[model samples]
Target: MTEIWQRPWWFTNSSKPLLQPTWSYLLDNHGSLLHSHLFSALFPAAAYFVICTWFSCLMLIGPSQWRVPRPQILAVGHRSPSERECVVHTLLLSLFFVLPAAVLQSVLRTHIELPSRAPTILELGMGLMASLLLFDTQYFVWHGLHHVCPGLYRSVHAKHHQDHSGLELPISLAHLLPWGLYGGPAYHDKHHKSHKWHLAPYFIHWDRLAGTLAP
Candidate 1:
């Protein structure tokens, strides 16, 4: 058996076709559509609108919960890059991490057999719902751990919180390196601290199953 890490980016285990490989195929196809939309005027405008809206919401809602006292933010940066630089660098690093994971998932799908019959629209909807729920659960658990533990938080998770303190961005494994190495506490810490509210991130189920969730 190939080590999970050693498996080719495209190789999924043969037995779990629907569960593992299907997700990649679906996401890749969906992403392709989204990419194509970038060439059209409407999509870019819509995307910008959505991004702006999201940022606005974060600024208004996230600060109350995610903001560390200015002193805490400054203290964490003692041996690291400035907050602005850290955010930019970590964001770039996260993109690098996510791109490969996405490619690997796509490669894994190539090893599986796709549905022989066209999936009914209902089946597609069900699959999407299931995937989303699973992802959220895993993300929440994984994120919670970056706060509950300190040693693991510092070495593998603190990188994200090194400068910033907040849950403005959607959390995911891709963001882990940034959060892990830099400082944000999976963004959950902010929510926990601010509102005592705990909601799951979108992709939490996978991390939980993979044993990568912090707590």
Candidate 2:
């Protein structure tokens, strides 16, 4: 008898695959190895470049009205890394962390059981909310700890706060105004500016309960 981990979920145990035949055939051949390499590594890296490029272009050449109204957040006389520097750093990060992690996930894929059927709407919604909450909780804890511990802040988190090494933040168009409930771009921008509050990424309640929510 096949082990439970070797089979799909009970509801979707039908012979039909969730994916179309051509795609299913490809998955049967290469499976998670191809998926991880293509999606987890290459797709994300490619997306980062493309999205960052768009952001840079928009900020540099787009209408002045579209720019963030706040004064430049960098401290006086502080120099942010140049475009080339950011690109080099991103490449190194992708090579060392992203690619290796994807490869590792692919290698371990067989040990993990996944549902074969497409999720119901309710399941999808629940999963998204769960993911958001989990991410927010983890982010809040880690970020708060870094701020509270001077050594951790100086050694690791300082560069992230100072240099704004991540380009993903600027991709969100909602930077002009803070969301009432969710931690929108403006919420995250406030955190970047203050570096002492708004540590939670999705829910504002975490910061509120922790007394770290900024006005």
Please give the TM-score that candidate 2 achieves against the real structure: 0.63
Task: Tell me the tens digit of each residue's lDDT in model 1 across 1-215.
Answer: 55766754344344444444555665566645534422233443445445645654565567465433432443433764565575465455545654455545554543334443334444566787678667676666676676677777777655654544344345634465443532233435544343223335443344445554455
The regions of model 2 sitting more than 4 angstroms off are: 1-77, 99-110, 165-179
> Against the correct fold, how does model 1 do in TM-score?
0.39
State which candidate has the highest TM-score: 2
Which consecutive 10 residues in model 1 have the weakest lDDT in total?
34-43
Error of 1 at 159 (Å): 4.4
Residue ranges of candidate 1 with Cα displaced over 4 Å: 1-87, 104-110, 116-121, 159-199, 202-215
What tens digits encode model 2's per-residue C-alpha lDDT throughout 1-215?
47656665533444554444655565677677644544555665566667766766665667665454442466678777665666676567667766676667655655443444445444555787788789789988988899899999878776566545222244453343356677665667678778777898767889999888996
Error of 2 at 158 (Å): 2.3
